[model samples]
Structure formats: C-alpha cells, structure tokens
Target: MATAAVAGALGLLWDWLWSERFWLPHNVSWADLERPGVGNFPRARHVLSAFPLAAGIFSVRLLFERFIAKPCAIHLGIQESVPHQAQPNAILEKVYTSITKCPDGKRLEGLSKQLDWDVRKIQGWFRHRRNQDKPPTLTKFCESMWRFTFYLCIFCYGIRFLWSSPWFWDTRQCWHNYPYQDFLIMFVHHLATIGLITFSYINNMVRVGTLVMCLHDSSDFLLEAAKLANYAKYQRLCDTLFVVFSVIFVITRLGIYPFWVLNTTLFESWEIIGPYSSWWLFNGLLLVLQVLHIVWSYLIAQIACKALVRGKVSKDDRSDVESSSEEEDVPTGNKKCPYDGSSSNGANQVNGHMRNNCWAEE
Candidate 1:
C-alpha cells in the first residue's frame, strides 16, 4: 500500500514537471507544436528511444570486448602478471575489506599482536593483497580499445552529420526556435552529460547539444589510443598521441567550446529567442560543463609539463590502476622482510620497495 502511494506521488510529480507552462514559452502551446502526420520535428517522446539504444550499445560493447579486444590483446602480447598472494587471515581480511587497506602504525601494532605476526610481514601482506585487486593489463588494454573505437566512430559520424547543415557554418542557427532540433553516446557514465542531453532533447536544443558532444568526442579517442599504445609498450607512439590529444583537447574544449559554442548558447541564443526560465537552466548546465573542461585542461597541462621534463610519457594518474605506497614482496618461507636478505637498513628496504613507476608502461 505504501509502495503504491509512493509510485502514485512520483507519477504526479513527473507529470507536473513536464507541464507545457513550465517548459514552453507563453506564445507556444502543445497543440500548436503537435503534428497530425509524419514530420521531421523532434518530440519529447523521442528521448525514450535512447534508453533501448543505450542498452543495445552496452550489449554490443560486451561482445566487442570479448571477441575483438581480447584477440587484439593476445596479438599485442599484453598478458596479466601474477602478483604474490597474501596468506588467508580472517582479522587481516576483515580489516582490508571493511576498515582500511593500509593500516596506520597504531592499527598495525594491534594487528601484529593479534595475528602473532611481524609488522613487516603485515605490510607485505597488505601490498600483495592490493595488487591482487588490480585488474590485469590485458583487461585495461581491452577497455581502452573499446572506448577508442566508440569515440572514433562517433566523432566521424558527428562530422558527416554536421557537414551540410546550416548550423555547422553559422553558430546563430542553433536558435531557430524560441526552438528546437535534433543528439551523443559517451554520456552513459557522466551524470552531468546525461542531464544536459536529456534537457537538450526535451527542449529541442539538440543542434547545440550535438555540437557539444562532437567537440568532446574529438579528443577522447586520442586519449584512449594513447593508453592502448602505452599498454602495448609503444612508448614513442604513446607520447606522440598524448601530445596530439593535449593540443586538440585545449583547442576544442578551452578555445573553441567557449568562444564559439558558449557564445551562441549564452549571448546569441538569448538575443535571438529572448530569455525564459528554461533558457537560464540550460545555460547553467553548459556553464557547469565548462568548469569541468577547465579543471581537466589544467591536469593535462601538468601531465604534459612533467612528460617534457622526464623526456618520456609519464604514468597517467587518472588511469584505472591506482598507485599504492606499499610494494614489498610477500615472503614465502621466512618471516623476515624482503630487505633483511640484502641489507640491515629497514629504511632502505622500504624506500626500495616504493615503486614510483606505474604498471601500465612497464
């Protein structure tokens, strides 16, 4: 009974949110916009079609990863490394999963006494356990390849679709109505992107939305390709692609998006259509996106500077593999730490185990 009542309330709320008065201008009505026969005009209902399309694309991605990307990984000689495993311990397992992967000195001291183990052994066990959780390099390669394929295809399609359109040349044509047009797939995980696309579709502001998607798609594939190259140990190729991606990312996201796209959406669109409540809401989302672009651009710049200084492509901090401070190898027989065999200095042993190099490049 409560579930039914909640559902009913939600249904009414959805209806109220999409009411004509809230979305459309005072001059336009749903009756005037509705078509009796087949027409090219975009409708609010058309956005529902994206749900099934998104699901289909996801299914296709799984197939592509297994069949295509897996074979490519084999051909490229990208194999998963077998890291040392941690011994089974209920107390340590509980702490690793629930409490913390890396226990502090106080926590470690308590755990050492509880387990009747040395502090170094506990540290090595945690290190090995963390490495176990990391997905193989082959898995990383396949994921990057899939994203690269998708982004490349979408960017090409965007170009083909926009080539002959009037709005391709004229930024002002995006505001044809007070109005609407007709689309992106890279928005699957990004909440902001999903919100923006849904808003654009409902408002018929698709022309500008498509442009925004294409602008982003332009550099995304390059980043993915660079990762694929890095995973395959093609250092020169990876560095080159990274440079190209950085340049294009800055050009498209920072230079073109704001100066051209935002100019039209904010100043030109307002001048053309006049301001409504939806207009402010739409531009606000676009601004939020712009803020993200700026933040990413700064990170890219830092990476590029570091790469230049190193004279090679540095490890991508943003990649799936997270860095850990602990790298001491788990002992098989003796309880002594890895460094005990080589040297008596504990500090040198710890520092030696600290691998600054990332897994992907190696």
Candidate 2:
C-alpha cells in the first residue's frame, strides 16, 4: 500500500512537471501544438519509444561485439593474457571500493600496520587488484570497435537527415521549435544528453535536439577509431588518428558548438521567443554540456602536450596503472592491455595506465 501510494504521488508529480502551462508558451497550448494541420509534433507518449529502442540497441551491441568485434580483434592479433589476481582481503576490498582506488601514503601506512604487511606488498596487491578489474585488451578492442561502428553509422545518418534541414544551415530555425566510470564522465555525459533530448522532445523542440545530436556524433567515432588503432599496437596510426580526433573534437565541441549551437539557443532564441521557465532549464542543461566540453578539452590538451614532448601518444591519461611486472611475465606480441601505454618498441604493453578515449554524447 505504501509502495502504491508513493508511486501514485510520483506519477502525479510527473504529470505536474509536464503540465502544458510550465512547458509551453502562454500564447500556445498543447492542443494547438498537436493539431494535425499545423505540424508533426512530438508528444509525451512518443518518448516512451525510447524504452524499446534502448533494449534493441543493447541487444545489437552484444551481437555486434560477439560476432563482428571479436573476429576483428583476433584478426588484428589483439590477445588477452591472464592478469595476476590480488589475494582476498576484506579490509583492502572495502577501502578500494568505498574509498580511493589508490590509497594515499598515510592511508597506506595505516593499512600496512593494520594488516601487518609491508607497504610495498600492499602497493603490489593494489596493483594486482586494479588489473583484476581492468577489462582485457581484447574486450577493450571489441568495445571500441562497436562504438566506432555505431557512431560512424549514426553520424552518416544524421548528416543525411540534416542535409536538407533548414536549421543545418541556419541555426535560428530551431527557435521555432521552442526546445565514462573510469567511465564516470562519460556516464554523466550520457545522462545529461538523455535529459536534454527528453526535455526537448517533450517541448516539441526536435529541430534543435537533432542538431545537438549531430554535432556530438560528428567527433565521437574518430576517438573510438584512435583507440582501436592504439589497441592494435599501430603506434604511428594511433598517434596520427589521435591527433586528428583531437583536432576535430576541439573544432566541433569547443568551437562550433558554442559559437553556432549555443549562440542560437542562448542569444537568438531569447531574442525571438523570450524566456520562460522551461527555456531556462533547457539552456542550463546546454551550459552543463558545454562545461563538460571544456573539461575534456583541457584533458585532451594535456595529452597532446605529452605526445608532443614524447613524440607519440603513449598512454591514456585517464587509465589506472597496473603492475609493470605483469607485462614482463607475458611473451611479447601477445601482451595487450586495455588502456596500456605503448612501449618504445611499438608494442602495446600492459601494466600502464589506461587513457581517456571514450567520450559519448547524444
């Protein structure tokens, strides 16, 4: 009974949140927007389709990874070597999960004294523990391949659809519509994207929403492709593609996105339609996305600086380091680690930190 009551209250809240008075302009009504003679506008019910679509995408991803991605990884000679596992320790496990993955020196000293183990042993144990959780190199390759394929296809589709769109050329047309974990950043980005998309769709702002998606899809595939190259130990190719991806990322995300997309939404829309409650909320989300862009761009700049100094894109900055000894134990040519730094000899070595290669937007 309590559950039902809570659900009922939540349902009412949702309905209240989507009230036409809140979402639509005072001069416009939901009924007027939904008129068949006016325009084909999105309804609240239409957003329900995302559920099945999400399920279908998941299923497709599994099949694609299993069949296509796995085979490609094998063909490219990406192999999985067993990583040394950390011994079970309840205290350490709790600390790793609830606290920091990498313990500070002071915490390490405390843990060492409490566990009656040397600091070096504890550090080694943490390294092995980190490796245990890090996905296998083959797994990473397959994941990147799947993402590359999906993003590339979507980008092409977006372009095809937007080619004839008026808003593609003139961003002002969108005002008429009125709309990573280790992947943590990517995770937040996905959530933000979903929020923006859902909010825009509910407000019948599909034109601007589509533009946002296209702009994002434009640069994502390149990053995935670079990861694939890095995984395959194609050092030169990986470095080159990383450079290209960085350039495109900066141009689309930092340059075009703010100047073109945000300008239209922030300045042009306000000028044309003025502000409303929903309008402020929508723009606020866009600004959130822009802030993320700036954060990522700073990270990419650091990576580029390191690459320039070293003359190659060696490792992913976001990756956690595993034990260096692990790579020493594995035979060369078969030792591939996810997010592992490439060795000077052009072999992708395990036991290095994983880089931040996966960035998703919708």
- Candidate topping lDDT: 2
Show model 1 residue runs off by greater than 4 Å.
1-15, 178-193, 316-362
**What CA RMSD would candidate 1 show?**
8.4
TM-score of 2: 0.77
Model 2 per-residue lDDT tens digits across residues 1-362 = 99999999999998897786779766777778667677555556755656676777889999999999999999999876677878999999999888646588899999999999988688777778887876777888888888789889877877887788787899887676453001111221233345566666667666766677778777777778878888888877887777777678779878998999899989988887787778888888888888877877776666665666787776543333456666556654586643443422121221111122222343
**What is the C-alpha local distance difference test score of each model?**
0.68, 0.69
Residue pair clashes in candidate 1: none
What's each prediction's TM-score? 0.81, 0.77
Which candidate comes out best when scored by TM-score?
1
Model 2: lDDT of residue 336: 66
Candidate no. 1 TM-score: 0.81
Show pairs that collide, candidate 2: 180-183, 180-184, 180-186, 180-187, 181-184, 316-355, 319-354
- Model 1 C-alpha lDDT per residue in residues 260-331, reported as the tens digit of each score: 999998998878877777888888877877786787677676666555676567543322232233333324
